[model samples]
Target: MCFLAESKINRIVFLSTVTDSFPKRHKGPSLTSPQRPTMRLASGHVAVQLHGEELTKIQKDFKGFGKGLVRLTPGGWLLPAPYTKFADKIYNTEFRASDVVIMTYPKCGTTWTQEVVWTMRNNPNFNHPKAGIPVKARSPFVDSDMLAHLGKDVLNSELLELVKDIVPHPDPDEGLALQLTANIPDPRTIKTHLPFSLMTPNLLDTAKVIYVARNPKDVVLSFHHHSRLMKSMSYVGSLDQYVDYFINDQLIYGPYWEHLREAWPRRDHPNMHFVFYEDMKADPMAELRKLNQFLGTDLTEEQLEKIAHYTSFEEMKRRDDFYREKEMQRLDQEVSKKDGGFFRKGEAGSWKGHLTDTQEAKINAWTKDNSQKLGITFRYSL
Candidate 1:
């Protein structure tokens, strides 16, 4: 295992301990009620304090995610870093005539959106039996080794391949490293955390996008916890400290407001629509119907019922393989505090259970300002 600095260990341990505190007794609407428009992310409810290196780590990680591929872009706009060597594979892959893009900041609703879209396009009656095929096999990561030979293309050694045997891929083609982006970024439904500036011009020119939004409080709660599980990010500090980085535009593609703004301008172009996870949870059936119409498909009543039945929190937990890779089979041992995998508790309004009121409001304020600056006027109740 790669060893982190001793100080880093202390930082992680401290934050973990704090976030693990007992949950406040829910008083009805606190976790579920809508926050008033005047109530902001920084509403004196949540307070975060972080110092030194832990703060620096987040700044660095964000910079890296932003610059992944943008050094080659003209103005440094959409700099989402793909695996350098495999960048071409993602840009040049064969795309279907009818593919739709699902874009979001990580941990927003990427997977759920995938499920929603898959149901909409392939089986409108998401509740029906056998509504769609296995996901990973069909939804490949454009720049990862599942499709491209990375190092040979960009001159870096292979990374993250240990998980390769666990994740499935759609095409059995030679994982070719060619860049087909001369025409446009390939595949019908590519995933990205890229800002608007760095993305190749062709990506926006030809594709329709479905962008997902989540409360910044929740995003930080989920994302900071996620870093703990991702080996590359094990060194970062607590959610509180991470919030500082987030506010400063120092988290991956963050300044959640800025990264989000990159898409908002295009949200109403007849090819883009923004969906909030909160809204999805509050009215899933309605959202599913809206999604169905957007995808240009219709679902039978039976299929719709089946989808609603299966994608529930209770149902997803019952399944052994919702968002898990086979490698997680080893993680099946007693759950560590880190939770061992990406899917964690996919519940909404989970922020109150962890973040102090001060910190929650602070993040919310940052969220509100950025939301306005960037033109995203969505609600983030919870």
Candidate 2:
């Protein structure tokens, strides 16, 4: 079967880590009716029924971390099991001339770049209501739930309703990238964490792609915090252990060096533009102007200034809070009052505080060695 068609098959069952601690001898009570009960893997969560071989296959394909399992795709990338099928589907999707793809490894400056690019592309007037609506809705992550949830809550907010004319809201029911492109208007802005090799060839050929790179030390630190924040991939491992996994390329969507090495040669591709996260942090306005030139958005100096102000780290954090609060209310989930919200510290070199001297040296050596192997050079710090 074609990979795309195979992706539609729901053969794999995903059971959360909470289900893994059931007593060995106790098969547990059935989940359904007294007469015809179904055996459950755990309490509270629904049981996933799978054949013996299917269960074996899933176990073989997934690597366990603390309390979560990261599914390993045939291509060797790790992802949450629920998203593996979606990731496979993304590789088969096509792209358009007007599409702008923000590609990066996770926890890089993906959200920041998304904000900058979306603002430059859509809000040329510099007066779009910058509050309430989530940045995910503005520039949907095409391979994730962001596309389906793009405008689901916009109609609830009168403030967001004003920019419906500016930002094309995608249908909530539309989950596939192909369907999303068909429905949403031109100049579609999308985000993805897939490495360059995994992305669709047509997308690379047609759409303009903005590749964002971050110092690996910062990427590892930010990713550790992010993993703990996300429920699906809850990680309780030590920073040392995490760094080991990071160095060994065992973390989800990592092997960071290889992801960069593959993308660096293509930096000069007509449709690909490389932007460093630290550079954006150093001077966002200059980066925005360069991005504007690349995208052909041609925003005036006044508009650029306005966009720079509104999308500044502080402003974006405030907006993110508004969006997160709304989501908490909508989902009826308790919010964790943590220091690292979605938009964590936007400073460069913050990794120095978190990484040990040994860890820093290891990262530096690995980065230097890999860059040389790939015939590319990178500045380690801002």
Give the clashing residue pairs of candidate 2, or none. none
Per-residue lDDT over 81-182 for candidate 1, one digit per residue giving the tens place of the 0 to 100 score: 333323333444444546676778768877777666765565453453433334433343343332222112322122223223332432223332122111
Candidate that scores best on TM-score: 2
Q: Once superposed on the true structure, which residue ranges of model 2 sit more than 4 Å away at CA?
A: 1-75, 128-132, 145-182, 329-338
lDDT of each: 0.49, 0.61
Q: How much does candidate 1 score in TM-score?
A: 0.64
lDDT of 1 at 31: 18
- For residues 135-166, write the lDDT of model 2, one tens digit per residue: 65567566664212323332234223433555
lDDT of 1 at 312: 65
Poorly placed runs, candidate 1 (over 4 Å):
1-82, 88-96, 123-134, 143-188, 320-325, 329-340
Clashes of each: 36, 0
